[model samples]
Target: MGTLEGRLKGKVALITGAARGQGAAAARRFAAEGAKVMIADVNDAEGKALAGELGDPAAYAHLDVAEEDDWAQAVDRTVAEFGTLNVLVNNAGVLHFSPLGQTTLADYERVIRINQVGAFLGMRSVVEPMSTAGGGSIVNVSSVEGLAGMPFLVAYTASKFAIRGMTKVAALELGERGIRVNSLHPGMIDTQMVSDAAGGAEVDFSRVARRLALQRVGRPEEIADVALFLASDESSYCTGGEFVADGGATATHALKL
Candidate 1:
């Protein structure tokens, strides 16, 4: 649907959390690259709307990434609707900010359920179909927090770190099957999740950006571009790698010179 030439021609991609944010951005980019995309999310209204906007090459499938049955059904629906599963973008996640002591066990588990377990299920659910389709790519959206630690985001950091580890393990195991698994680490992206983590307060992004090499907050579309490369043959030799889209936030430590 875009003016750009096809980079993902004839491929079928399933993107979780595709109702909005980075997930939606990836869906649009993938479709533009000539890939049939399944927008899977619990937000039925937005998901359906996006699918409609993408027209014939896109469809919506209701999915709760935390639910195994939901993941199973979503994958089945994707393969049925698109005829094969070639790419997966596990972009659904929740952010919770709380100090280690203040973070409840329930809160930690909830974050893990969606961010960590959700990706595990997604990768597991698609292996057979993707293998059958002659191998595919799986991009797990982790965070800059995954590579390092940050105060007050105890649970979120843990889940993201888990995703990073899982991606490497999956890549090692699925490499021979032609499945490439990679983790994406983003920093200070302007999204609803960041807003929610700030308790709906206006974020002074400029202040956060000043500390990074790029000196700006990242856009969802920027991350989507990286996802596009991972999903396409452009990254054919890449697997079990960490793609950091942060504004160089992780390049330095606390002792700011």
Candidate 2:
């Protein structure tokens, strides 16, 4: 295949949870598309290493998504390093699996803080800067659970649903300022987050894939591609939309014979 043209040229982006997994994939894609990227995460070593790999156009910022101050610093650093912030990908999140009754308040709050509150802070922090830059895109990485409830994922589902709702609200409020906000819902992605949720064991997605329309699990790169489209001007007409990259998992209503 021929090399793809730069779709994000002249853009500056900050992506949370970019040390690894889907966030890292999106960071790489953005850089490849000619965007100056800030790989923000708490994982310093990996984030810095990825920045080095991506060379001059990318840098790493230490960001603990749950902390408001960290969000401020990350956004400031991105603008300081790259001139302005044109894209913000709220991709940092946490997952906890347990029966609703068994889930502790502490665990539930932790998930909410990172997955929901974190995105909120990110959006708020970027608004002014993005508006000054003449508008930008904010991609909130939600999940399939955001659209529907799943067993043993109460906290995660709640947080994702919050992100989905927040995305719409931000889009509506920010549209006048030329900023676009959208949510991405990915399902059964092969990432470390899923492995950790599965108790550090490999996630056997074979059975789950059988129920989906595509009959396969998704890759982090696939979701990254969708994010790329949303971040680039190609999706200028899209805002407050739920862009699902789930292998068609949400296309059916669970009906058994």
Candidate 3:
């Protein structure tokens, strides 16, 4: 695509959890597509390194998404560097896998605080700036687990579901202000988080592929592409909606006779 045709050109975006995984992938893609992005994460070393690699000022921040104060500072920093903020990608999250009985309160709180509350604070912090800028987009990174309950991962699943709900509510409340809010649901993907959650458990990747119509685990870029769509003017009319990029995992029938 021509540079002007780059859907995100001239947009200033802030993405949390950007040190690695899906967040980092989205940061790279956003920069490539012509958006000046603020890569926010608690991992200062990695975050700053990524910013250096992006080779731009205003490209990194030490943002702990679960902390409301950190969110405020990140927003301010982005505006101070980029001149304006047009997109907020609530991508920072934590995953703790355990059965309901085994899940600890501490783990649950950490997951929900980062995954759900972080998104909440991110929208709250950026909405005013976005409205003043004439409009903006907020993309919350949800999960397929939000759509269906899994055997393990009670805390992780809970947080994702909460995000999905909050995304819809925020969308409705922010739409009149010209700000759009939406959630992106990703299914099983090849990432360090997933591998860590798997924890050496014997699982068949091919089996997972066969379960989904696409017959494959998704890539970070696959989900990032959806975020890009929701963050840009291309999806100008979309808001308060759930974008399921789960490779048809949710569409399959439960009963396979």
lDDT of each: 0.94, 0.93, 0.88
Q: Residues 168-255, candidate 1, lDDT per residue (tens digit)? A: 9999999999999999999999998788788999878988888999989999999999999999998999999999999899989999
Residue pairs whose backbone atoms clash in candidate 2:
none
lDDT of 2 at 142: 96
Give lDDT tens digits, candidate 3, residues 1-257.
Answer: 32446779889999999988899989988888889999999989988999999887347889988888898899999999999999999998877778899888888898888888888999999988999899999999999888888877888888899899998899889999999999999998777776666685655688788788887989998888889899989899999899998898888667843
- The 10-residue segment with the lowest total lDDT in model 3: 1-10
The TM-score between candidate 1 and the true structure equals 0.97
What are the clashing pairs of model 1?
none
lDDT of 3 at 234: 88
Q: Supply the global lDDT for candidate 3.
A: 0.88
lDDT value for model 1: 0.94
Alpha-carbon TM-score of each model against the true structure: 0.97, 0.98, 0.94
Ranking by lDDT: 1, 2, 3
Once fitted onto the true fold, the runs of candidate 1 whose alpha carbons sit more than 4 angstroms away are: 1-4
How good is model 2 by TM-score?
A: 0.98
Q: Give candidates' CA RMSD values in order.
A: 1.3, 1.2, 1.9
